[model samples]
Target: MRYDNFPDHSAALPEVTSTWSYHRRSSRRGAEEINDESAVSSEGEKEFLKVKKRKHKKIRATSQENHHWWYAFAVVTLLAVATRQVGLDLPAGTVWDEVHFGTFANHYINRTFYHDVHPPLGKMMVAGAAWLTGYQATFEFAVGKDYTPDINFVGMRGVSL
Candidate 1:
């Protein structure tokens, strides 16, 4: 029976005779019921929960991977510092090109102009470090010569580190 002639309160009664006639009486309410039945079904609810758990697991794994990278970076930084700092002042004498650079640094301290193929910035830094360490530029810095007691050679090499 057509429910258009009945009052709105009458539509809420369970007197609806056929599925098609009941749906036509209240189309919006009928659609809501259909949707609720499908979504709240046991199988459908279980599948929804499974998908949510998978998404949460994937997000947790991604966060753990990010932490792994941070740990790796920290380890590498510590190793690099340890390798550079160990035996920094060993042998107690000039090694390699220190003979030439040390002479340039001495010239800078003594205010005497000297010619060298290298750029002046590096020589100036060494000179500044030597000055800060109270080195008097008295040592000749000759190859294979042992460092004097007052040269502050460790402080100068620390600048390179």
Candidate 2:
């Protein structure tokens, strides 16, 4: 008998149906496929986190570079000020172009007319500084001549710088 009239053919043929391994194998394969998909998604998340961390590290490095540049600028500025201030009062008098510029400054304070080869703005600055510092604008400027102790040429030079 073929058992075609049976209401449940699997129930009547339990041994043959139970021995069929295709259903179990298909179920196991489906479970493995789900696991593989989940593993791939987790790995992708890990990679994305790593990339984000790398970007953060780059930002930190850039910030550190900016700090370094600011520190360098500060150091250079301090060194320049120290260098410029060194021996500022040693000469105690006019040197180099001071003879020309200083005379022009004096003339400016006295309101006297003068002609200059260079622009007058620099002389005006010197004259303004001298006037602010209580200089009477009577100091004679000659090359290699020492300034009097009463004159605060250092203060004037500081203002010019």
Candidate 3:
């Protein structure tokens, strides 16, 4: 049945509860949740509210823990880099595979024509690094040979890393 008058409609509607207004205020103000509401009559509702509050607190705690993990990861990464740098240019010599690849890099710097079974991109990058380090590309990079102290092989190694 439809009510024609406003008074009849208003009288039929249930009274607004304090719980609803309290929740609204809590949402707006981030205030402490009110548990002493007379409107919450069911035990199940109170338990559900308690669970929800706990969930919110847990989410905040998890985010803080996640942030700490991110910082830990960063520190570990930095330590890894530092340790790797300790012996980055150790042995001071033409290491494994440098014979072929380093020759290719020298060829690129000298603009000399050479044939290789592999792609030339990695060699080109090494040659670019050599240019940055003022390497003359004239130094012979023989296999199983130690690099002389004069060459800036470390710079090339840095670029390779």
Candidate 4:
């Protein structure tokens, strides 16, 4: 009875025997046998197919429910992105050193200013972004590319609202 003595060879037929297994064996064509003593399995193949399709299946929430969840998620994400961007943008124009540093950085890049009181790291960070986002960084920060400088207060409050 042990598989160690003889390999299961339904293939070779040299060691084939009349012995059979309790589990159903698929035919050479791979179709399973109809195990209906009441002649029901042969009656409706479509009925068997419908039952078989549902046998190992799981149910998920409908697309409408999923859509609601995703819609809420998208709204929340956009709100967060808008709020953070507005927070960074609320105070338009350069502050104290920023004005001088930004001007100095612009000049420095174009070979304009030397001799600094502080590090160029902060200026460099801002300058790098300005260079990337196109001209007009002298007014609004380079970070806000799509923003309107004229509607500063309204644009800022729009994101919060």
- Pick the TM-score winner: 2
Candidate 1 residues 44-101, lDDT tens each? 5445545545665743467767799889999999998778778867879898878878
lDDT of 2 at 148: 81
Per-residue C-alpha lDDT of model 3 across residues 72-111, encoded as one tens digit per residue: 9999999987876777677788887777778988888898
Model 2 stretches with alpha carbons more than 4 Å out: 1-64, 159-161
Which 10-residue span in candidate 3 carries the lowest summed lDDT?
16-25
Displacement of the residue 121 alpha carbon in candidate 3, Å: 3.6
Q: After superposition, how far is residue 144 of candidate 4 from its true place, in Å?
A: 18
- What TM-score, to 2 decimals, does candidate 4 have? 0.31
lDDT by residue for model 2 (108-139), tens: 88999877678778778888878887889888
lDDT of 4 at 152: 37
TM-score of 3: 0.53
- Estimated TM-score per prediction? 0.51, 0.55, 0.53, 0.31
Q: What lDDT would each prediction earn against the true structure?
A: 0.75, 0.71, 0.75, 0.51
Q: Candidate 4's C-alpha lDDT?
A: 0.51
Quick one: ranking by TM-score, best first?
Answer: 2, 3, 1, 4
Inter-residue clash pairs, candidate 1:
none
The reply for model 1, stretches above 4 Å from the true place, is: 1-75
